[model samples]
Target: MFQRRKVIGVMGSGTQAHRERVIPLARWIAEHGYDLLTGAGNGVMRTAAEAFVAVAGRTGISIGIVPGQATARGYRPRPGYPNPAIELPVFTHLPLSGKQGQELASRNHLNVLSAQALVILPGGEGTRAEAALAARYRRPAILFGAAREFRSFPEAFERLATLEEVCDWLLGVMR
Candidate 1:
């Protein structure tokens, strides 16, 4: 019997790592034998991937969806992609992100669609856009952050204040 390993996507700020929350969450995902998926950039993405990779004897690898655009030379990853922690990098030609993250040109679509479940951290517009896509796609997703960070987000996402709640929600959804 063959079974594919599940992938857990973690979305958040490209500038703020939120290490206090992301490190433990990422390690938990790795320890549980689930692949870690992210935007493949800095901040939360990098932090999560780094933490996931650091876990000893973990079965899952860090998977990063890198955003880029076609140039005269060829396609190139956008600045700060893959962040050294990604064991597998899925490069894309879609360059749009941030305010335009919901657009077709953004790799956020793939990030939201590919994962079995998602964990959202405190982030900016780009993270919000990913959250929107998760809701639109009807994926099992939970926001792991303070209420103020996601006040304007869709009501479908349950905001969790503690890591324990986030882990419980992840276990429920991933199951």
Candidate 2:
């Protein structure tokens, strides 16, 4: 029998928290048969993609929401970097430039409508924006690791603990 895929939005940054939590958690999501969603780029997005691929072995699908328009060309592996666990599905829409400026406002805007639930890891302004958007649409949001304090909506769920806690919460949602 076919099962409905649960697209879990993982909002995080391309920094330390991502190195510690976001990457591993995303891998777990895939191992458990859930699809992973994120803004396509480096840091958390890259880490999650790697982890998902690691867990899925072969049949993983990693979908990315590009800030601007995707090119007719598909994703090309950047030289000297790890290939994504699965193919990169880019949803393009330009918003900013540079490292920090690469923040994709459009991706944040569409996050809630694109997924069943959002799991926010620690991040900067961009991550906070995605979490806020999820709440604005009343989508179920669980804040894992950091970003729990910045949570400003009643619809938001916060659990600052181990990855096991995060997994338990997500599995509960699945059930």
Candidate 3:
């Protein structure tokens, strides 16, 4: 019987790539055969997808939750979405993000709910909202980055300073 691969969501800034931190984590996730899930815009999302797809011979693929909006011309993908690295784009009509990420209409809801686990990186309001949704939904998650970066974030998610610790947590959660 075929089994579905677990998806590991990486949430972070849509403007800052955070490459030094996201690249290795994405590679490790791909190397381990877990599908990578992201917001599919830019910054951490694009960086993570790029790294994940660059892994040679990896079975896992990059999945992006693309946000769109309804207009007089019908729904259209928001600007800068699907950032070239996404191999599997799951587009949605929910455009609200940032401060409204937790709202029902936000695509952040889909990003949080679709993944089996999550790794949160340095980000802004939208990332914070994703972190909140992760906690609210009880998904296994870890804040991976410097503590200072998430000073204003929720205290519920355990924060890890290194990728090694994050990997360990992922192994435990996945098992």
Candidate 4:
């Protein structure tokens, strides 16, 4: 749950395009008065955090549900990937790489639980899983990117490919 600011969960890939798209969206979200929620690893997550900080003038309280233990190695947001915008990062000791899909599933569940809405960018299996979970939860999941990438996912909610459309929805419809 969010405290002072409304929390919007962003699920996107670590890919380059995902980074480009999610970052601005994150800035818009912050400018419009909302907190960012993400996986907090790399690529899209880092960019979002960075953008939010840049626009907000400081890294507001954004949640990063990391997928590992609370150690130096796990806590660090990765080299050359520092997002000063990131404030609080909640680390989960569950090893997402090892066996037991239960851990990853549980973490994803927690990620969805912490947000009121979702913004999905192009990603792989993990991103898809988060999107699917958000839909099943009946939360508004906004898909942003090119039309082809949006086509790949199941169209269960409002789908907007452009930043303007996405922002309009976030301001008018989603609000």
CA lDDT, candidate 1, residue 1: 100
Ranking by lDDT: 1, 3, 4, 2
Residue range with the least summed lDDT across 10 consecutive positions in model 4: 94-103
For each candidate, what TM-score against the reference?
Answer: 0.97, 0.74, 0.97, 0.78
- Model 4 off-target regions past 4 Å? 1-4, 17-19, 56-59, 69-84, 97-105
RMSD of each: 1.0, 4.7, 1.0, 4.1
lDDT of 2 by residue, 1-175 (tens): 9977678877777453456787678878887777877766667777887777777363547777665543578543333223254365654454432333324445566655677777877667667667666767777777776545545433456755678988888888766
lDDT by candidate, in order shown: 0.93, 0.65, 0.92, 0.69
- Model 4 local distance difference test score: 0.69
Residue lDDT tens for model 4, 1-175: 8655678887777554465577778878887777788877676777887777777364346778776544765453333332455577776664352123224535676667788778888877667767767777777778877768766576796677788888877776445
The worst-scoring run of ten residues by lDDT in candidate 1 lies at 145-154
Q: Predict model 3's lDDT versus the native.
A: 0.92
lDDT of 3 by residue, 40-82 (tens): 9989999999999999999998999999987899979999888
Better of 2 and 3 by TM-score: 3
RMSD of 3: 1.0
Worst 10 residues of 2 by lDDT: 75-84
